[model samples]
Target: MAKSDTDIPAGARRRLLALAQERGASLAGLSELLGRNPSYLQQFIRKGSPRKLEEGDRRTLARFFGVDEGELAEAREKSYGATPPLGAGWVEVPRLDIGASAGPGALPAGEGAFDAFRFSRRWLAEHGLEGARLSAITVEGDSMEPLLNDGDEILVDCTERPFRDGIHVVRLGESLMVKRVASAGGGRLSLLSQNLAYPPVSVDVADVDIIGRVVWKGGRI
Candidate 1:
């Protein structure tokens, strides 16, 4: 019997699942990335013959996998040898406003410490992070100017870990600092500022809480 409009082909779901796993995600991980219910995803994947994915769901899944929508859809149609059409759907990722990361010897969790910013969910999903919860904050002061000037828009992903030397947004105790992370001693990390005016800050491993790694930044001249 032919499937109805709402039903997705079983093959499509299998291929989609396989593609997601290939991209380093488990079913549980996918649920967290897509902000979907785990049980629902399990049931959805368990169908003897899955139905075709909805446009919105397909887009979400594709964005999560960091692949073009057509690539995901085409995998299931390999036998046919025709390229899959691109999927059309997107969501925005919001930004949080952090007034300031605790600066030198400041305590944590003080009042008026952080703020949030608004952004498009679709734009954020288009990048590598879809399921990640993000917050927006405006960059202030020239502490990190030139590269990331004051008033630049920054999107923060709290779930990501800081690994190797790269740009990251961090809250050391109560102070927020945007600096390059580098190896210190043992497991300790150093926050380096490019401006040179600020010396390298070597922090004990226990005192640092990396809010998120900075993926991208946008600001006006």
Candidate 2:
């Protein structure tokens, strides 16, 4: 008998989500990579479909996640389980399940939800970043190439008010984008990109809201 979606073990779901976050991927993107509908994995996570992942799908996911196929299978057979509690000296920073375009603008369907990722407090302190104002987002385009690649996850410092010269995530009009912003002063700001093909876009500082300044970037590899 196939397991119902509601029967998916909590540990299994957590493991999958952790793997996805580590790889800077979404369930929807992972489903497409496996040649399934974009929503296949999402349904399994949120609604439980196909009862159990087919052997091929399971194998592919296991390899991509750098885990043994048996591990995933084990998760399916087990019941919901408790996760390890975070140890002292570790701080969890919110990584929003949202994509920020480094190239063209993107209009997210809805606001993002944050699922915190634990980091070493020492490491964060060394970098001079406050975990309170830190949030993460996935890069979706190539405009900020060389620095931020597609699929790379970036941490934005929401408390870094007073924009200056740096790469920033901003919401211009209805579209949100990540770009290299330079202050033109006099109430104007310039959005630049590493890719010369994009040219430069200038806008009034008031017209575009600064989301945050990007402080860190990471990718699966």
lDDT of 2 by residue, 47-149 (tens): 5565557656767999898897545543422211111225678766656666788777987554444466677778777888634366677898998888889
Q: Which stretches of candidate 1 lie over 4 Å from their true place?
A: 1-88, 101-126
Q: What's model 1's TM-score? A: 0.49
- Find the 10 residues in a row with the least total lDDT in model 2: 76-85
RMSD of 2: 14.6
Best model per lDDT: 2
Residue 73 deviation, candidate 2, in Å? 42
Q: Clashes in candidate 1: how many?
A: 31
Which segments of candidate 2 are over 4 A away from where they belong? Answer: 1-87
